[model samples]
Target: MTPQNTAGPLPPPTERRRLRQSRSLTHAQLAAQVGVGPSTLRAWESGRLVPHGSEGETYTRLLTTFAAEGVTAVDGPTAGEGASAVEAGRETPQAVVPQPLTPAQAFDELYAFCAPALVRQNYLLTGRPEVAREAVERAFQLAWQRWPEVARDRDPGGWVRAAAHDCALSHWHGFRSRYRRPEPPPADPADRALLDALLTLPPVYRRTLVLYDGVGLDLPETAAETEASTPAAANRLAYAREALAAQVPALAEPGELRRRLRPPATSEEVRAADPEPVRRKAERRNVFWTWAAVACTVTIIGATALAVRSAPTHYEAPIAPAQAVQGVPPAGVMGPLSREERALQAKLRSAAAKGPYRLVPEAR
Candidate 1:
C-alpha cells in the first residue's frame, strides 16, 4: 500500500525514520491500536529508542491510513439521478493537522470523559436498561478509531453521545432491517393516536427529539457533535417536540417518562465496574507482561545455572594445616606414579622446595 504522507511530521527526516514514526502511532479510537504503553511512546517522542520490527510496521500503517482519510468519498445522492460531473483539477491540500496522540492515550482520555454521559443517554433514548451498557461499548469502539478527532473537540462527551447513539441505532436498524419488521407501535390509547404519528415523522425530527429532550443533551453541544447548524438543530428539536407530543400518549406524563428513562439500579460491584474497553485492554497487556517477566526471569536463572554447571572446575585437594601435617597418605595410595606425574610433581615440589614429596593425582 502507498504510505500515508508522513512528509508532514518532523520534516520527513528520512524514509527509515518516517517508517518508524508511522509504526509508533495510535489514534483516539478502537482499543486495538494501543500495543505499547504511554511511557514507551514518550520515550520515542523524546529522541529515545524507536520501536522496531513488525510492531513498528503496524503502527506506521495506522498513521498513513488515516493520514488522508480521504479514505472514502464524501458525497451523497443528489437530485439529479444521472449527474456525472466531477472535479477536473484540485488545489494543494492544506498542511495536515498536528499529529494526534496515539490511539491508546486518546482512548484513555476520551473514554473517561464520554462514557458516563453516553450510558445515561443510552438509557434515556432506548428506555431499555441493558442497552446503556451495549451503547457505551459500541460508541467507544467507533471513537477508538477516531480518538484524536473526538478528544480534540470542545465537548467530547457530546461527541461520544452522538457516536454511541449512532452505534445503537445502527445495531437496531441492522436487526430490524434483516427481520423485515418494525416494533408494534405503542399501545396506550394516547400513544396509539400520537406515537404512531411520531414514528411517521422524518428521521431528523425523531433523532433531534430523542437527543434534546429524551437524552437531555443541549442543542449547541449536540449540534457540534452531530455536525448540524445551530438554527437547524434548534428548529428540528422544536419540530420533534411537537411531533412527539402530537404522536405519543405515554409522553404526556413527563414524570412517568423520566422514571421510565432512568436506568435500573445495578449492584455496587457492577456500578463500580471499569469500562469493558479499558478493562479488556488492561487485562490483555497485564497477562502478557506478567508471563513475559516470569519467562525472562526463568530463562536468565536457567541460563546462569547451565553456564555454572558446564564451566571447567578443578577440585583441589585441601592442604594440610602445618600442625595437622603429622600424618600423610602414601604416594602409591591412588596409583603407581607415572613418569610424567613424577616429573610434574618434582617440578612442582622443586618450585616450592617441599621435602619427601609423594604426590598422587585425583581421577580425571
Candidate 2:
C-alpha cells in the first residue's frame, strides 16, 4: 500500500511516544510546544498520567498533526543514525509514512482518554454519582451529534467538560423526583466536610474552584472556559477558597487546598458509559428531531392551504333600513263632521226635485 493510504489519525499513547522518538524530538522540545513541563509530558507518555485541560488539547493536536504527516517508528541503528545526522547538523530525521485512522477511531480514542476524569470531576460538581455519570454520558452524546464541529475544535475535551458541567449543575434536576433526594456523603469526615463546603458555595464559585484548583487549569484558561473575565474568575476562585478554608481549616493553605481538591476517593462509584452507546443514542436523537421538524412544517402548510381554499371570493352590497311613510292620516274612531258638510246636506234635501234629485259630489 502507498504511504498516504497507511497514514492514520492520532495513535495510542505508546505509539505516540514512539512516534515522537521516531521524529528525534526530545521531551523538552515537545513539552515547550504543549506548554507544560517535561516531567508532565513524560508522565503522559508513560501512561502514568493523562494530559488534560489546555495542555491536553495542545498535545492532542500536536499528535494529530504528526499522524497526519505519517510519522513512523525508528529503532536501534536507525535511531542512532538519525542522532548522528542531527549531531552532524542535519535539520530533521528522514520522514517515513505511516497508516492513518478514520474519524470514528479518533473520536473513540478521545472519549476513552477524557471520560473517566470527566466523570470524577462532574461528581465533584454535583455530589451525586448517578448524576455525574449521566452528565458525562449526555455530554459525549452531544459531542457525537456535533462530531465535525468538536473534531475541528481546539479543545474537544474541554468542550465535553463544559457540556458535562452544565448538565450536572442544571436547575432542571431539582424538579425531577429522581434527583430531588441527596446522595450520601463520603465516609471520611474530612472528605465529607470538604464536599459540603464545596457545595455550599454558589455554583459559579464552585465551578471556578474546580477548574482552577481541581483540574489544575491556569487562571486564563479557567476564565476562558468559564466565559468570564480574568479578574472575575480570580475573584470567584478567591471567594470559593475562602469559603472552603472557613469550613475546612486543614485546607487553609493554597497548596494544601489544591492537593485536597483532587478527585475524591469516593468518585470511583461513578462510572461513565461506553462510547458506542453514546454515539448510537446521539444519532437516534438527531434523526428524531429531524422528523419532528418535518412533521411540524407539513402541519403548518396543510392548515394554511385549508384556510386559503375556504375564504370568501367576492363582496355583496348590504340592504337599506326601513323609514315611516309621510302624509298619512291617523285612523282609529271618526270624530263629528264640519258645519259645511251639514249645510250641504240641507241644500241637497231642499232642492231634491230638480232632476230626480241627482246626488252631487260634495267636498267635506
Top-scoring candidate (lDDT): 2
Query: Candidate 1, which segments miss by more than 4 Å at Cα?
Result: 1-117, 123-132, 145-152, 175-202, 215-217, 247-273, 276-364
For model 1, what is the C-alpha lDDT against the true structure? 0.53
Per-model TM against the reference: 0.35, 0.65
Q: Per-residue lDDT of 1-364 in model 2, one digit per residue for the tens?
A: 2122122333567987977865545564476456565557777888767666666777878887776666346543476686797788864655556446577777787787778878888877888889899999999989988989987775677788899999999999899999888788887787788778888998888999988777666687788878999999999998888888888888889878866765453534677888888888888999999999999999999999999999889886778789889999988577776799889988887788576657778899
Number of colliding residue pairs in model 1: 19
Among these predicted structures, which one has the highest TM-score?
2
Each prediction's RMSD over C-alphas, in Å, is 27.1, 11.8
lDDT of 2: 0.78
For model 1, residues 1-364, the per-residue Cα lDDT tens digits are 4333332343122543454344443322211242433334344444454544443555456445545442344344353432433232223224444466665765665566456645655443443335556767766665655566865664455566676777655545445543354444333454344434544667556566655544544566447556799799998876765665555555556544433332321111112125555547545666787899999999999999999999879987889766655578777667689999999998986766555465656698
| lDDT score of residue 281 within candidate 2 | 87
TM-score of candidate 1 to 2 decimals: 0.35
